[model samples]
Target chain A: MRVSELVQRSGASLATIKYYLREGLLMPGEATSATQASYGEEHLRRLALIRALTDVVGLSVQKAAEVIQLIEGPGDDLFLTLGAAIGALPPYVESSNEQAQDYPLARTALERLGQVYDPDYPAVGQLDRALTAASAAGFPVDDDRLELYGAHVRAIAEYDIDHVPEGPAQGAIEYAVLGTALYEPVIAALRRLSHQDLAMRRFVPDSATDPAGS
Target chain B: MRVSELVQRSGASLATIKYYLREGLLMPGEATSATQASYGEEHLRRLALIRALTDVVGLSVQKAAEVIQLIEGPGDDLFLTLGAAIGALPPYVESSNEQAQDYPLARTALERLGQVYDPDYPAVGQLDRALTAASAAGFPVDDDRLELYGAHVRAIAEYDIDHVPEGPAQGAIEYAVLGTALYEPVIAALRRLSHQDLAMRRFVPDSATDPAGS
Candidate 1:
């Protein structure tokens, strides 16, 4: 398709599309002539992914590029590699039974989480970081909240894994990455919806009973 | 504190701080001299909130300014108003549901959410629009995924409401908006973590998992 058609189909303007192309965010079309180029489905999908990363989820072009590169790169273990990278961050302190001797209550709960759902170590480790960050930031997350989040994560993971069509390992990875990319917006909307749910429970007398009121 | 001090404390740079003041994202400080201005806790908090929206979440300066305006605007009912606004433009839809529905899922969720939540209509509306545009552009998403996101949102909301000292309305709004705004990084991290959890369960030998796994 022409650039104009691409713009219309993508719901992006000519200028914005040009900006993306200039930034190397959108790959160039095949140069059919001095002034003309052709695009295909790959370009469409790539552009769509770029839009989601930058425009929807609000990643910087730089950060989005890094993530996109990771997804598009030649590694079969990108998820594992990315997990390792995240786990190495200084702030990501896990609450292993051995590691959590400093915080017995937190340690006990971590063990219990292991028993309930049996998440792998990486999941637990990152949740530890998330919990730590939230707590340090003065949010009132505790063992209960962390455990709840773990359960929720497990549920979503199960659903996502179950739904994909059977395919080769690379196909599975791409399907998961590209398909799951949609969650950035989906979850953002859900967060807004949940906020609305909470606010109604708090402020509107006519709304449902407040879940947090207790 | 001087503007530089405010910048350090708020984790915003001097230039970004100036941009915020110029853009009305932050209220100006009392000018001590032509080249000097003093800031206080209010400025610190506002600057942090602005950073959360603009830098962390990647909202454009213009859009971030609008969100700041709505947040700072007068009313005991701003939370309700914000919820209403967020609901109006909701961010997700079940592809299957789009055809049968009048509004998109995000919008419908917001409207329905309004009936159950408070009435922060405008912010809710903006959030919905942003999410919808993002989803349409193909950031990974599905309805089941969004429902998990709803749970995460509620968890954060509960934590913020329960933890922040006194929990003034501005603080609540800030907590909510910043939570929503900064969600991209948070969710990205979580997505990586979740993927790691799944991969470990499937691929790793059973005796021991990587401590960095979870």
Candidate 2:
């Protein structure tokens, strides 16, 4: 369909679609005329993902662009790869690159995570790609923190797979939808709520506390 | 302890402490003499919580103040309270003027959550408080979505209780820490990794038919 039709179907404005195309976030469809191009399902899906990340999760356009590229790239072991990307784990760093070697603490953390998870060979490569994407986007996680995050990821993913209904395959798809559709708002809301609750609990007099319990 | 001592123990700079005081986020310690007010352990803890919310999570002083108020107030079924606070479910609307007929939507959602969980009264209250805390901090969740989140939270909490090393009490604490401390970064990493991995598997030319299966 034409850009106007794509906008109506996708629920995105024509200007926004143009902006996305310019930013290389949306690949244009086959050209029907000098002024018109046809879009299809792929564009719709991409638009939805973009909305989730940018509008819902609040990632910068540049960062979102990098994420889109990674998603559309070539790799195996997507689950593990996704884990790495979300955590900003580096894929491969050469030994002699001084800047890359700058944070020993972070690098060590990543290494330790690799040791603990035992996610097979493919898992390691995927983790590295995520790391690369994070670095390229300039998210401020150090290697050590990345690895710590990796361990946490392993735990949550394990918990999610083991616990969610209909086995890992179905759970995986639910997870993807949840992450894309619901994760951002849920997290943002929870964080705001917890912060307030903790702060209030700390300063207020312990009225409910029983002396006997203490 | 004087402000100087409080500063040393809390690791907060004098300027920051002053800011908190001005913002009404931190209450003044007991006054022992002119220019020599004394703070105690309670002050120290409150300061730490404030720093976590403001410095780490990046909430504004005004927003932080409102959250702190709710946390300091009466202890009730937190889940229910949170639901009320965030409008995820009907919050019982504590004030006298709030009319029994108002907020029908919120009331319904809260009732649904109460039925599904059958949590003891306190747990319901905590969940409500959590939701409220999140809402006041500007998480952008409406009452209806919060009910959906309540189900997710219930699922995760139940699953963790069943599987984790400790009993429900300890498990609850652990999940709280994990959710509060690690969920944000971890989820971000996972989303990135998942998207790239899936994209590569589905779209990358000449790659294996299923990268994950491979």
On lDDT, the leading prediction is 1
Query: If you assessed candidate 2 against the hidden native complex, which CAPRI class would it receive?
Result: incorrect
For model 1, residues A103-178, the per-residue Cα lDDT tens digits are 4333344555553213433434444444444433334355655565556655665666666657666556555655
Scored against the true structure, residue A169 in model 1 reaches a CA lDDT of 64
Considering summed lDDT, which 10 consecutive residues are worst modelled in model 1 chain B? Answer: B85-94
Task: Report the Cα lDDT for residue B8, model 1.
Answer: 76
Give one digit per residue, the lDDT tens place, for model 1 in B112-131.
Answer: 33335322243434345455
lDDT of 2 by residue, A69-136 (tens): 65555255545544433432212234454554344333344344433222232233334433433333
How close is every model to the real structure, measured as TM-score?
0.63, 0.46
Cα lDDT for residue A59, candidate 2? 48
Candidate 1, after superposition: displacement of residue A10 in Å?
3.4
- Candidate 2 residue runs with Cα over 4 Å from true position: A55-62, A74-84, A88-115, A118-214, B1-16, B30-38, B54-63, B74-80, B84-214
What interface RMSD does every candidate have? 6.5, 11.8
How far does residue A192 in candidate 1 sit from its true spot (Å)?
1.5
| Number of colliding residue pairs in each model | 43, 42
